[model samples]
Each structure stands twice: as C-alpha cells, then as structure tokens.
Target: MILENNDFKLDVTSEIGRLRVLLIHSPDSGLGKVVPSKAQDWLFEDIVHLDTMRTGEYDYYVKLLMYFLDPDKIKGKLADIDNPESKRAFFKPDNETFHNSGKVVEIQTLLSDILQQKDIRKKLVAAVCAIEGCTYRLQLQLIDIEPVELAKIFISGSLNDEQMIFAPIPNMIFSRDIGIAINNHMLLNKPAKKARARETLLVKYIFFNHPLFEGYRDNILEIPDTVQHFLRPGEEQEGKTTLEGGDVMMVSPQHLLIGCSERTSVSGANEAIKLLFANNVVEKVTVVKIPHKRDYMHIDTVFTQVKRNVWVLLRSLTIAEPAQDESEPIAWFADKKNKDRPEIVQFRRGKKPKTFGTLEALLDNISQKDLQSTEPTRFIYSGNDEFPFDAREQWTDSCNLLALKEGVVLGYDRNDKTVGAFQKSGFEIIKVQDLLQKFETGELNPQEMTDTLILMPSAELSRARGGFHCMSMPLMRDKVH
Candidate 1:
C-alpha cells in the first residue's frame, strides 16, 4: 500500500519543548451521553455538560492551541468564529467551516480521512461491529453509510442525535491515552479498561494508516500482551501488561518515564523498558509506581514537569513520609514498601537499576543531570501543599499541566490553591480568555512568553477527570534548548 507522505514530522524530544504540532479531540456528542451509573465504567468520575465543555472550556483550548501552534488559522478571526449564528461550525470536524489546521490536528478528522479508503472502511466497520456485538444488519448499514457520517457514529455511537447504535466512547476526548510520541517514534497504548478498548482500536488504525505519518509508519511501536495473558486468573489480572499514554512521559531526548498506576501495570513498564532499549529509542527508562488508586490514575496525575528546572507535584504521595501505625504492624510494614511513598526505579541498558527515595529526588536528577540545568530544580506543591487542599486540588488535576514551552504551562483555573502556588513560584498567571484577548491585541507574544500559567475554565471539563496534558498528544516539538 502506497502512502503519500505529508509534511508532518513525528517527533517529541522533551516535555517542555516548544510544541510544534499535536493531536487533540474536541468534545463530541459522545461526551454528553455519559450517564451517572455508567460513568465509572466509562472511566469518568462524573458526566459532563457537553455543550459547556465545547463552548465554555474546550473551545478555548482549541483556540489557544491554534494561536500558538498555527496562529494563521485563529488570528483575526475570533469574533467571526465565536459568533452565535455560526453554531460552532468552526469547531466541528464534520462541518465545512472547521478549522482544519495542519498543526492542531483532530482525531475525528484523521479517522474520517482513513475511512475514505474502501478496504479500510470495510475492515474498520467489521472490527467495530465485532467488538460492539452489533447485528449483521447494523454492520451492513454502517458499511453502506458515507465515510464522514459513519466515522461520526463510530465515535459518538449515535446514527443521529436521537438514536444510539452502541455505547458511546465518552473518554475519547482524552486523546493522550490513545498513544504517545517518544523522540521520533510513536508508542501506542493497550488500554487498561474495557471502556477504552474501542479507543485503542480506532487510534491504532489512524496512526498506522494516516498519510500524515506515512514516512514514520515503521517507527510506531505497540506493546503486545504477555504470552497466555488471557489465561491469567481474575485475581491476578492487575498484573497483566496494560499501558496507557497517561503513564508515559517523554522527559528528555535520552530519558523516559513510565508510571505504574491504576491505569498502567508493572509488567507494562517492564515491557516498555525492554522495547525502548532494543530499539535505541532512549538511553534510560524510569518506572514510577504510585499507590494503586483511582484518584491518582497515573504518574502525570501525581506530578509533571513545567520547565527543565521546575516541577509541580502532589507532596502527599510523592514526598510525604510513610505513615506507620503500630496497631497494624504487618500492614504498616507493607505500606512502607509501596503505599505512602512512590516506588521509583530507573533502568538503563546493561546498567544496574537505580532507585530514588522520592519523586522530588528523581525529578531533580532529571533536571540537573539528564537535561543539564545550571540551577537546582524547584518544586510547587499541589493545593499549595496544604492538608485538605492538597488532596482536593490533586483530585481536580492540579499537577496535570501541559507546558506550551519551557516555563509556560496550561492548567485548570479552578485550582485556586494550586494557582497560588504557581504565583508564589514567581510565575505570572492569566485566564485564557484574557490572554487570548491580549494575544489579539498584540500585548503578549506566545513565543516570548515565559514563567506563565494560562488558566482554562474547568467547570464542565474537570468533571471528565483530565487536564490539558491528558487531552493532548504531542507529535512534534522543538528539542529543549
């Protein structure tokens, strides 16, 4: 099969590198269908107001990304784009007025693009039908429908606004977990939960089939399940090799971090380490395993890098001492090994595994040693490291941030305590709406922006339990200088 290569480059060398291009999914109708009872099964803590997420919250994210990554699409068009009469046509992937910027790419568009091929469309329709257990008649109907509308149904599970053909993949908006970019390679995820199974299938097809990644097809890595994984007992299923992009962080060109959390298994990290070393994708890989809890789903939920010399983290899980209770001596002893404090271990090819006592120590090592920063790494605690606030803000993703460039990041506006922490760290904070206006007025330039935190509204977006980092899959970024 011949694939005509586009001008897009598949690369991401550092967390805080200047983001050149990324993949994101705007909130679709599927996000609106998450009912309370099925929320947990669907990987959402609570159902979100789809309209508000689209117009009030996620719209700004698309605009901000466009302004920074592809300014020509957004510049001098804010008022016309937001005009009520437009009915958000500018943001809809299926609409004619959609801002199909080459830099700020959309998953839905890519899905539709691949579906245009006859053989691929037939295969994907059959695959989805088999997974969803659809009737033969429904499968035929789907295959007959046009590619654009069929692609929408595949994501939203609805033929139209009123009828749902299958369960909606509501979690698709968090595109990061679909795959991750490591330096010049793309490592896809094998999702941990049944709810995200369809997402994985759809994304795998996109990355392998999309023309934009034509030249880099061989660089796409997949983590296969362990031999006889299906035979694993139910009680031991947690040990199965399940990896998600949320747990994978490309910190530097030579280093990577894999988190063992609720969404990623220990075996997954082990497999990833072996693969990266065999491929020479990186020189070192660190597996950071935190307590298996839903609140802290992945290591990104616990901490993220803001710059080469700065990081934001949840002190309770990353740095707090293990609380020992003498009443339960055995349990307390066990907790010390894996509970309160994170288990940090770094692995390199043909080298002894190195361990760190705390996340702070590991991040500092990355800043000072891996990236060679001149100054010591600085830390900002979630919720300002206060008792209830730390836990509260962490739940809302205070630590989950996406750096636009070194020292410039994007996070939820509602995390007031975390916002205060950033302010104390000598970073200027501005709301997204205000910042967009400033950009329109030429008051601030994104390229020159530094030590800044751009706050995004999260009333509806936060209910989905992810941040900008989870919502993004960076494809190309300038090497951190």
Candidate 2:
C-alpha cells in the first residue's frame, strides 16, 4: 500500500480521532509455551490457556479496530501474509544444500556470515518465521545420559559441541512489546529478558522485509552499546536500566510518562529520553518511578490516558508521591567574588524539583479536574481504599485501561471500585462483550464513536501481570490536544 498523503502526523493533540489505520498481531500458539515452569523467567506472573486468551484478544482487535478504521483498513502481520504461495516463496531455498560432509562446515560458516550481514539478517529472519523453525530441540537420547557418562565421554574426546541447535521463538503474538513506532521512526526493542529476544528478531524482519512498510524500513533504531553497557553490564550489575514500550505511554507530542519498575530502570528512562530528544524526535518526557515489584514493571501498569485531560489509573500509585523530577539540572555559579581573596562563596543550583506527596494533595494543589490539560506531569495515589494490599496488586495492573479514543477506554470489567472511580470522574464504561454486541447490532457506529471504554475480563489475562493497555500497542492514534 502506498501512503499518498501524509495525513497521519505524529504531533498528537488528542486521543479521539477519525480512526485511520492500525497494526495488530493475533495471539498464536506461542502463548501455549508460557507454562508455570518458564513463566517467571519469561516475565509472566501466570500462565494461561492459549485458546481462550486468543479468542478474547481476537475479539478485542477485530471489534476495536473496526470501530475506528474501515473494517478493511486495519492490518495484522499474520493475517496479511498467510497465502500458501507466499509461504512457499519465503521458505524456498536460495542456495543448494551441501552433499559432502565437509560441506557442513561450509554451510555453518555461510550461516554465521549471513547472520551478521544486514541484508541476510533480514532474509534469515524472514525464513525463520516462514519455516516456523525452532531454534532448540529436546534430545531424548541425551536426556538419559548420566553426568558421569557425559563427563567420561568429554574426557575421552568423544563428545561434540554441535548437539544443541537453535530454538523457535514462541512469543511473537504480543508484538506491542517487541517493537514500537515513535512518530515516523521505528525502534526495535531488545527486551531485557532472554525469552523475548526472538520478538525483536521477528519485528526486525517485518519492519525490514514486509512489503507494506518497505519504504520506511531504514528508520529502525537500535539501542547503542554504550547505553546498554551502562544500564545492563556484562559483568557486575550495580543498577537497573531496562525499559519497554509496554511501560512507556505518550500523553502528548511533547510529554511522555515512563514507568520505572522491575522491567525498567531510572537510567533506562534517562537514556531513552536523551536518545529521543537528541535525535529531535521528541521534545519532553516525564519519568514516573513505579515500584520495582514484578507486578508494576511499566508505567502503563498503573495509568493510561483515555481522553483529553482524562486518565484511568490505579488511584494508589498515580497519587502516591509523584515521581521524582527527572528533568536535567542547570548549573551556574552563585557568586564569583573572592576567587583570589580566599573568601567563602556559596554556589546555587537550580533544579526542576519533583512533588512527593499523596495523590489527593497533589490534585488539590493542582486544582485541575482534567489531567490532560494540566502541565505535562504525573500523579500517584495513596493505596486503594478497598484493600490496603490492592496497591501492590493494582500496580501489577489492576487499574490499567486501553483508550479507543479520547473519552473511550477498556479495562477489567470486575474492577468495580476502580470503575466507579472512573464513572465518578465522568467516564462512560461498557463491558467488552456488550460493546461487541453493540457493534454487531449496528447500535454503534464504529467510526463515529470517539471516546468509549470497552472493559475486558481480568480473570485470566490479569494474572499474567498486564491490563488492557499493557497487552496492546497503539500503532496509530488521534492527536491529543
């Protein structure tokens, strides 16, 4: 598809807009691999059945996208490229297989070389997805081998290092966390966790090789080694520096809120802003420091903007001490006298100090009923009123909501206390199932509905430590004023 008109400007002014285009990936079998054994390692707090989750998520994308864009306007990576001929073409061999045993070494050498090249990187990544190849395989024979036997074989020089191969990436369905588009630029994230690295690879291929976005493929950005080393060192780890798009939410063209938690770090947020502003891509950002607990890893875990000056948040964290002011400081000499006289002089420093207090106090001081119109800032809440422990649980995403437009959003239908708070604040809430029915019955005009909230059930997806917004990425949004 050709973008004849550059109508979709990144300078967002509001969340409600005429839905134009969006990108989504349906949940697939990869979710099935998230078992109790590997859940924690993979950053999942709980494992869920793939079938139900996929069904629910599918309804989410289909119904949600149909509301904003032309039913045919929205696109999905898996849906667009499912043609049999296309799959055959992608997996067709470009080179002949080796006939001689020695040629195996040649093949290995070629594979290694190709893996490093930019063009071949694209091709190989495409092939991996096309072939659905697993990078690792279980060796039944090796499973029974005893430590003594393996050690003796190794000592006798009878063991080989090539026994293990590559493993398949089983988590591409959650495409939002793997790669993101900031304005017109694309940044393929290197997820700090090992289990999600394949997500980055798959996204790299789609951005580079997909015919729909071929023209802008070169806009991809990578994390610099210097920043990576500073945040996540190869040796002794002293500080945290991991960040993900799922945790970062843009409130406006100039303001961004980054969540600092177990999955993201203070340094990571700083470095990301430096890179973004240095590249002239973004002007300002607000770093919101969330607890390091596993449940509240990203900013989206607690808050999301639903409409202009409206937000649905976990009242606890948003109103707790507001995030420390992460703005850069200005340095100046207070006085230049007595340099040679050896007289005492005071040095004054100026800083954009942060407000640390209860959420009610902060809001009272700001005197702003709407959050969007306030000076670009973040708010934290005291613990939940219903249950003191709800803060930790909610921070794990008990309150996150997804905005279909400025006034519209989606959240867990059962969070009545939280939903009551939103309704009190002037939001109109609807269950996801109800909304789907509205669309089906033609009671709702998908394109005409600007700001609406469609709540999803948290009985299953929430245990995995994410809310509606965390599980989704908005490829396109209306400019928020």
Candidate 3:
C-alpha cells in the first residue's frame, strides 16, 4: 500500500477533497438495446438513443474529467482507449518506451484465463450462442480467436434480435454505484438490478486481474448473479443482500454513511457495517433509510455534500414544523435501547414505520454531541420554499452534486433552483463549458478556485436521472483540510 510518486493510489476519505484519479464508463452500443417495450426492466427510465448519449452527454462528461486530471490517469472501457497512443498513455510505462506497457499484455492474459477455464468458457459461449440470431457453430468458433479480441467482444457487448446475449452495460456510465474505494482498499459491490450486474462483473475483472490493479486486494460483497436470481428459488428475495456504491459514502476517516433505499437494502447496509467494523475501518456507521420510491432510489439522489460542512438535501426529508415525524423516520443510527440485540430504529414499508426529529437526531448522529452553532453544518434544500419546484427539481437529480474540492462542486445546470441555492451561499456558479473554455485557453486554474460550482450539460444526462456524483467514482482524492 506504499504510494510511490508515480504509482497510482486508490483511496478516498472525503467527498469534497481534490480529486486525483477516476474510473468511468462512457455510453456504448448496449444503450441501443434498450427498447421502449422493456426500458423499465433494463433499469432505464426511458429509451435513449446511443448516438445522442455518446456524442453529447457522455462525450462532454469525459472532456470534463480530462480537464481536472491527466487523461492517462482516467480509467474506462477498453473501447474508448483502443488506439495504441491512448493505450500507451493510459497504461503504466514499462520503461523508456510507453508502448511496452503492461496494460494490454496483462488484460490479454486475464482474458486467456477465461478461455483456459472450461466451465467458464462454455457458460459464456453457450449464453452468446443462445441469442436468437446467433449461429451456435459460428459463435463457438469465436473461442479460437485471440484473447484480446475475445475480451473486446465481451466488453463491447454481444446481441441479437430477440434479446441481448450480453447486454452492453449502458448504466456503466454511472461508475459511482459499481465499486467504492475506502481508505486504500476497494469494496466491490453487488448491484441490485440485473441490468447492472454485468457492470459489477466487468469492474471486478479489471480490478482483480488488470495489471494496474494487480497488487491490490479487494473486499467483495458477493450476491446472486442476474441469471441465478431467476434459475434458483428464493434467489429473488436475496436481493436484500444487494449493496451499491451509490448508497455508501465516507463521511470521514472514522465515520461511514450507508443508505438503505430502493437500490441498497437494509440487509446490505448491515453487512457493510459488519465488514467495516470487523476491519476497524470506521468507528461509527449511520444507516439512512430513504423512501424506496425510484425518485429517491439512493441517498445521493436526494442528498450530497457540497462543502466540508454543508449539505444539499431534499426538502421533503427535513420538515418545517420540527415536531419530529414520529410517524416516518428518514434516518437511523444504532439503537442503544437494544443492547442484547442491537438494531437500527424501526422505519420502512410493509411494517408501520416511525419517524424521528430530523434536526436533533441528524445533528446528534453526525456530530455525536449537542451543538450550539448551526452554521457549522448548513443544510440547503433542493428548491426554495416552493412545493412543485421541490418535487420537479428533485426528480432531475438536482441534489446530486459532486464536490471537486472544499467549497467547489459540480452539478446539473438545468436545476436552476438548486444552483441558485448554492449561489446564494456565496458559491460562484460557473457553467462547464465556460470553465472548459478557460482551462483550454489557460485563463483559469482549478487549483486556485474556491467556492465554485461547475454546471454541466443536463439536457440528456438529467433524462438518465444522474448528475456529476452519479457519473464519477473517485479512485483517489487529496485529504480534505
């Protein structure tokens, strides 16, 4: 775990620290597989045109990342870094010559392992060959092809008319939900939805076998694969064990925040809490139970840290009349009332849920003390004292902002109210294009900026219901001051 100046480090201790490295997946042809008939089943709210997302939505996101970090430091799908020059730039240099790097060789060897394993190879080929339009003989012959090409086929996605043999992971663009980095270690999560299961598998392969991650060990939260859920009885109910990176966050080195939402189950949060405590990684854990509805699928969907002590949250979660919702608790901490069998407070559907006072309980759990100063941690609601605006903006992921550094964040430009709220707090709201232009012209430097919020294009990305935080998975970040 010793970090050399040139060696890549995998650690993230805060949300708003200066970003050092990132992992992302740009949109691919798999998005085209999402037909209107089954868009919901595929985890997509609506069918999106692959070309539009690739050229407009995804391309702009990649450009923004390249601006903050060296292109070589950003990791993504093999298709995006297919060329020799890109490969050389992306992989670690072997010697004086960059072309001799270990990336291709290591990845190929990893693919070779898949080909070498009889059961795995058969399972993979059988799945692909099963596609309605695929010829079993022709597809089976693909095994004889080179390892690199085979890997490409696997990643690029294979499909036929009726159904996708290997559905291109369109959702991979949201890397934040696939894997999470804690301190110097990696936590590989098992995605709840079948559509995103392939994403977890792909990311796991890269981290476990790729040369760049060869020396690292990952603590994986394993669950049933997509196929297993349907094939095995009671497997569908086991989804309670699912955990996603979107529902997990690092509040500080000593504290961890896990959300039990539509995407992350209470069982999953419990498992993560157990693991974090067992590893002594964190001293305390907070399990926030958000509404199970899709609009509030993940905690980040309705809440995000904007600065060191400031948070942007949905107004619906926190109340104006502070009597405490004793009927609907939105957050939970370890119940001290139960010592023999410690449990989180009762809240959620099916069973009658109870609510707790938001301000007092949240402050107590977060600060672990009675605080006199309220300005220490400010909470900004998504919309102004407006009803429809709050519901409307929250649907577009207005609260899901990603902090580049303390006081500087990134979010969707379309959320005028949310952006205005940050601006009202003395944040300099700058458009992504404006900043990109400045970076290109050498007119602005991110290292010197403070209290800024860079707005990104959201015409298409917002349609996907994600913002900067959902799009990014920080591999490393400078410790916040």
Among these predicted structures, which one has the highest TM-score?
1
How does candidate 3 score on lDDT? 0.63
* CA deviation > 4 Å runs, candidate 2: 1-19, 72-173, 215-218, 227-236, 239-241, 318-384, 392-396
lDDT of 1 by residue, 318-342 (tens): 6456555768655423443335688
User: How are the candidates ranked when ordered by TM-score, highest leading?
Assistant: 1, 3, 2
Better of 1 and 3 by lDDT: 1
lDDT of 2 by residue, 291-312 (tens): 5655455556655555554444
Error at 404, model 1, angstroms: 0.8
Better of 1 and 2 by TM-score: 1
Model 2 residue 323 distance off true place after TM-score fit, in angstroms: 19
**TM-scores of all candidate predictions against the true structure:** 0.95, 0.66, 0.76
Q: Identify the candidate with maximal lDDT.
A: 1
Give Cα distance to truth, residue 234, candidate 2, Å. 4.9
Clashes found in each candidate (C-alpha, N, C closer than 3 A): 0, 35, 3
lDDT of 1: 0.88
